[model samples]
Target: MNDAPLLEVRHLTRHFDDVAAVEDVSFQIKPGEIWGFIGPNGAGKTTTMRICATLDLPTKGDVLVNGISVLANPDNARGKIGFMPDALGTYADTTIEEYLDFFARACGLRGDMLAKRIQSVAEFTELGHLMGRMMDSLSKGMSQRLCLAKTLLHDPQLLILDEPASGLDPRARVDFRELIRALANQGKAVLISSHILSELSETCDGVIVIEKGRLVREGKVESLASNVSKNELLNLRCLAKTSDVEIALAEHPGVLKVRESEGSFVIEFDGDEKDIADLLKTLVNKNLSPVEFHWHRIDLEELFLSFTEGTLS
Candidate 1:
């Protein structure tokens, strides 16, 4: 989509009395990108999100939404962002349609425009069926969908979601992940914070890790995984005996260990791509007749644990 970043945070810092809530944190989110903001409780994830949403001003830094500075032009920056907080304070008596209509009107939409925007977000979020339902009576998943619909009413270019998947069930989490991917595909930049590292690893293009109100690491999920991973899991399926393959792999230069499970050989390899290629060549020379060989790389959880001490606050 666009070459320029849709959201940019430059050395953002926030302090309350003597406590530094956030310190010199900086990151950028380009259009059609989903960046995961990850950390434990009280790690300043919410504070950073508030700054980007223009709800709270940074003490020392600046945030730009579509090149509009949050410090210099907060109203303009707010217009470019749709912020969904951890707790969506909804009126219990309001129906889904009315809720969306109210937000659309508040965003300066009216008449045909309000109606069209409500209908569009309703259809997109699949909230049309629940239009007549009261907010208090809806399920957790349905309420989250409604909140997302409210966030989309103004058609903002950037979405800052704080713990969006927090109380969602397994099925609801999957559906929400798909919905987020769809939004990014439509050229919207999404910066989402969540404690679910495994899910974020699957959906986000990259992640930023913060601890003790300071940035610790920020990069693509895959690249970080590769860099921090010390070993690789490779599964091999061969026509020969499993024990024979295991012994052969154990003696290889790059292989750390080998085990047999079911009808395949599981190998722990400590090597790079070229090493893997050489391994395959060695296997071919040994006439192992491998039917399947696949490498299972490290995941986000491992990468995150490598950097953090695994403690909240």
Candidate 2:
């Protein structure tokens, strides 16, 4: 197995005349990892993915797939990457199997090898039953699956999927998530974009958030949530009224603010685990018995909101 990163983007920037679609973005995806590419409308996610797929040129910077630069060797880069655009166009007259077969042939697969690859992807994507279905007659979810199967026909190491689950139903989304996980387990690197932050939080190993074409943040989901610079929010349910507990917490240097909730107090603390322990000790020392203490970790949605001001291109 290759130890190098499956995909690497360094200072990627794309300009359309006077408009900058993407600017100075950089990130990497390792083998067996699924990275979520997230941003609002017109945030340059598509442009970046296009450049990574070798379908578009970058005004500045470069993309490397398996250590091969896309700008320098686009054909080689394309050979290593399979790109599925957000809006997949299908041949209205062709069947699902025929569509995949066309792409397989285009990718230079033939004979038993081509048939084997098609059947393998069809089975993996659960599209075997839909093989004879017309592309125009398939549901959106099934169409998406067919597109994915086509992308996988080439057996690329890195898969770049743009808004893959955009129109999927609940069950379809669940199945798609499982498929992505299975791909990662098979040592394929997946870079996917989606507007569904909650689902991304559950499915992605990490995420790269960009806004106005600039990279805002990139890290593992849990790491990014925990590393947010903002004060940590904690909830405390005390055996007694939170009056004394509030006062005690307010006096502690680690506690920034304490607000009363229905039956507990919400504390904004500026400290780490040791500081939290010290604060709890101080509360207990003040004769305040906390029946429940829970630290609220910042979720991906909150972190995204904190970075981007809900701005769209």
Candidate 3:
């Protein structure tokens, strides 16, 4: 993978009149990587994206695409990036082919070259079959696919997608994930903002979380997960009665709580990993015969809760 970022946001800030919509946000996205941009409602994700896309200018900061300043050269920036807004308007009378052709021409493509580009994008998005279908009659999934196809018409190096999978069903969501992976495989840098944490965790290489117009965290998902506090987590299954494990752990010095299920025991400790390890070793020495013992890795939901100050829902 390329080490240099294809896109960079440096202390980007945007204000509307007297209100700040984005504040000192910064992140970088390298080629062939999918970066997830997530935040609570009204967290300024769209505002920041708009600035990066050159649709709006930042009040205090700047954006760079392929090492060129977007503020200095917006037309050049537009050529290198594609911005897919959350809500797109579809022309009811236009067919899919016509719609893509129109956008291609608007982007300054023409003649045989424009037709070829349109056809290629349609085939790539699996919309070749739907080329003759009316844009207004397509399903949500089909429409989203068409929108993505349109975005690819110019073969932009960086794609900024705002909730591209918003109204998709489970199957459609999975297909969209596959499409993102395909784009990254083709060396395109993608910045996607979505509320689907699990889906984003599964597909994106890194995540940037924003809150109230400021950046909160930006890193690989695994690294961000590792930063979360994982205190009081225990996973233990016993060879003996589960009650035995629960009781033993509950009576331990640093143990805060012990819960027993059908065949397992969860012991919440009030100490560090070293303490937990010592406790486990003590249990083994005492012959309580625990079958499973491991620290519980926090899931994406828990990580999100721990990191964000506001509600993500």
TM-score of each: 0.81, 0.84, 0.84
Q: What ranges in model 1 sit over 4 Å off?
A: 230-296, 310-313
Tens-digit per-residue lDDT, 1-313, candidate 1: 6689999999999998898999999999999999999998999999999989988888899998999999999988888899999987959788887888888989999899999999999999898888998888988898898889999999999999999998999999999999999999999999999877998988999999998899988999877766664587787888877777777787899887676669877677878889999998888888888889998655677567768963211
By summed lDDT, the worst window of 10 consecutive residues in model 3 runs over 304-313
lDDT (Cα, tens digit) per residue for candidate 2, span 225-283? 76664677887888867567766776789777666768687677888999898878877
Give the candidates in order of lDDT, highest first.
Answer: 1, 2, 3
Number of clashing residue pairs in every model? 0, 0, 0
**How would you encode candidate 3's per-residue C-alpha lDDT over 1-313 as one tens digit per residue?**
6779999999998888987879899899999999999888888999988889999888898999999899999999899998899987958799988899889999999999998999898888899888899888999999899889988999999999999999999999999999989999999999999866776888899999888888888899888765654456787887876666666776789987665678876565779778988998888876888788887766666567767743211
| Model 1 error, position 276 (Å) | 9.7
TM-score computed on alpha carbons, candidate 1: 0.81
For lDDT, candidate 1 versus 3, the one ahead is 1
Instruction: Give me the overall lDDT of model 2.
Output: 0.88
Model 3 regions more than 4 Å off = 230-232, 235-251, 256-294, 309-313
For candidate 3, list the clashing residue pairs, or say none. none
TM-score of 3: 0.84
